[model samples]
Target: MDYAKTERADALAAGYVAGTLRGPARRRFEALLPGHPALRAAVRDWQDRLMPLTASLPPVAPPPHVWAAVERQLWPTVAAAAPSPWWQRLAPWRALSGLALVAVVGLSVLLATPPPAQAPVVVVLQSTGKDPAVAGSLVASFSGDGRAVVARPITPVAVTTDRALELWWAPLEGKPTSLGLIRADGVTVLSRGRLPGGLRGSGIDHMAVSVEPPGGSPTGQPTGPVVFYGKLQL
Candidate 1:
């Protein structure tokens, strides 16, 4: 196959960025990347497109037990030493608990504040195939203000290097409208300008994903099988 071809390089780069191109295929792609400027450019483009999605997501703090477990693994002698006095052990825990309490209170205050007129909508796109790599669901969340949407896969989807995944908004009566190309194994954020207006109305029915040639369907309609779909509930 001609890896230098724009479509071919883009498809391979998309799979690599999404983490679906793995094992020997992944290694080969990496080895070829340095020799192929087209492949490198494709990869850079994909990274720029997908990496920004993380900026909108809030960070999650790991639980206290996880840190304790890491400390035990790294410092066995200290961890295995005779248990510290009850007060000594409790002291550090107390401080952590206090900080957690403050955070909870702040979050509660935020949640108690008045919300936007439109509530956020969540849709779960179920896989049509039984293949283990594509069995899990994809979650699409529409912001309460209807200004943006974020879609994330629950598991990495195994797709060929010659294919890409395309997202669609399938209305109740009309044909599906292409949202954009999406990574099979990563988060995709669509701004309001990219989404069709009035998505919360009855005209909005389902969100779907279809396989397509790299760079998406050229005819402006799905050319391959629809692999995942879910009803949109507002």
Candidate 2:
């Protein structure tokens, strides 16, 4: 096939290596990998190219069972000719508690859980100054029954003027995605309907507050320094 289509196939190649390729696209790539050695090389090349982006990532050692699960998937049909790193055995999903649920109830389940309880306890994310003066304070609370979190900005934050703060939960080891932009009294409450399996109770390893751009970080990845990082405890 043509590896030079649509800007020289870099995007497609990235998606393929990232396992985001699906349906006919993935099937075509799989079939192509065996017969067209160059295509195989391209897949490997792309994976190698992006491997470092995730490196220097202060390794998030998966649970002991993670490697076993990985080997289970890999040992079935092994390839001896490849030269790949141990990390290559990893899948980004295994790192997220949502993976197990995604495999089971699927993404739709994120919307299916029951309603919140009546005894909700409020948790707030305050600005770095730790002054509690209410400039960039964001607040959220658990449903009285503790099924989900109601999160929202308490104020309007302009990155240039009022330091932008983003909220994140360690669904696993690292937190990705914005809970949403926050500021004092901006968004009264954001109801977290269902916490990913990873972030439930002590299940949540950690929670963080980041200083970000006005609208929030452009890249899905975090661009700002962590302002506050604390473990989730009972």
Candidate 3:
């Protein structure tokens, strides 16, 4: 592959930075970066473009068990202390009441069920603005079964109370269709019932997020500026 080509490099770098290029493909891209200056430049450009999206995200502390596991790996001898008695460790169980225990069991059963045969499709919607402070990004994942989609903001988006963020499925040759109104600060799930048919087909060209009224576009089309947009890889 000619990594020097701008179009090819940009596409691969975008996927790499967005975390959609994974496993062997990701490793292969990294290996080529050292030998290809254009590829390296593309990667740097993408990092600069997408890194700002994390500015509004608050720091999250890891769980206690995660730290404990790290400490065990770092100092095995120190972590080999005697296990506490069952009664002494009751504190953890106290948080899991009878109802919670039943819920956990039900979740375990659900998890044991087989996953969808197809792999999920992931898209990274990048901000269209040049300013980092005002720009935002979002990651959207379509379930393998094509029955649902989960949209999550990379950072909190500031919007007036009267305005809202809306997702759209833009086709190759026509006006975009509204997927649904999405949140600016949290994950939003759109079920199959909420979505129109032919999502898994080739009719759709790309996905976009547009700023709109609180209840979404009154005209069944985007009324506000398109703040973020991305191409569909499917």
Candidate 4:
């Protein structure tokens, strides 16, 4: 169904859910939701129905205390209903602490060690020469032989492209993975996304990209040519 009813407000309403409407359109929707229950319901319904198609996924189970936390969220007047203190009840803390300490050590090692300039993990994003393209260095790390990532977008490139630019991470190993697309604006904080199976620390030797269609490579693989490719030499 066409979401917009030719009404300015309805058009904004549709854009809010579809995520196509931004800035003023988004603000207008927020202002409209509470006063407009039908609009709210429409957005919620669209969210519930079309949400599966989007990138957001269901949550993994939180700790047992999470239910109490939810209670706190929904019913603030109610006290946290925990029979025992989590730290005392769970003996797993000792093991977890040990792991955490080991992680700290590993991270220290990583911080101290610099990546070789020739590493395969270093991938550059190449774009049309007409516009100043985003330069980035993708670093592949691993925990217990699983590929983890640390992508640092370099800003030195004098970006001058008219088309709104965004950065997407596509894994060379398995299915094209999303490292969250960048916003056209310079400072979009792309949250850490789910890691690919082969990328958990092994088999991830390189990274590639096809110019994504706007929000990203719509087909999940690069529909555009591999603008930039690199490998992990670390």
Which prediction has the highest TM-score against the true structure? Answer: 3
**Residue 207, candidate 3: how far off, in angstroms?**
0.6
Could you give candidate 4's per-residue lDDT for residues 94-151 as a string of tens digits? 7688778879998998899764322112233333333225442222222222333333
Candidate 1 local lDDT, 19-42, one digit each (tens): 657799999999999999999998
Which of the two, 1 or 3, has more TM-score?
3
Highest lDDT model number:
3
- For residues 1-234, write the lDDT of model 3, one tens digit per residue: 778897678778879987878899999999998999998898898788556545444555676889999998998887888486455566656745755886999799889965434555667887877333345678776765555788888656777788898998877899888889998888898757444554565367788888888899999998888888888766
The reply for model 1, stretches above 4 Å from the true place, is: 1-118, 130-134
Model 2's number of clashes is 13
Error of 3 at 63 (Å): 39
Best of the two (3, 4) by TM-score: 3
TM-score of the candidate numbered 1?
A: 0.48
C-alpha RMSD in Å of predicted model 1 compared with the true structure: 12.3
> Whole-model Cα lDDT per candidate?
0.74, 0.53, 0.76, 0.46
Estimate the TM-score of every prediction: 0.48, 0.36, 0.53, 0.32
Give the CA lDDT, 0 to 100, for residue 97 in model 2: 54
- Give the better candidate number (2 or 4) by lDDT: 2
Per-candidate Cα RMSD to the true structure, in Å, reads 12.3, 19.4, 12.6, 15.9
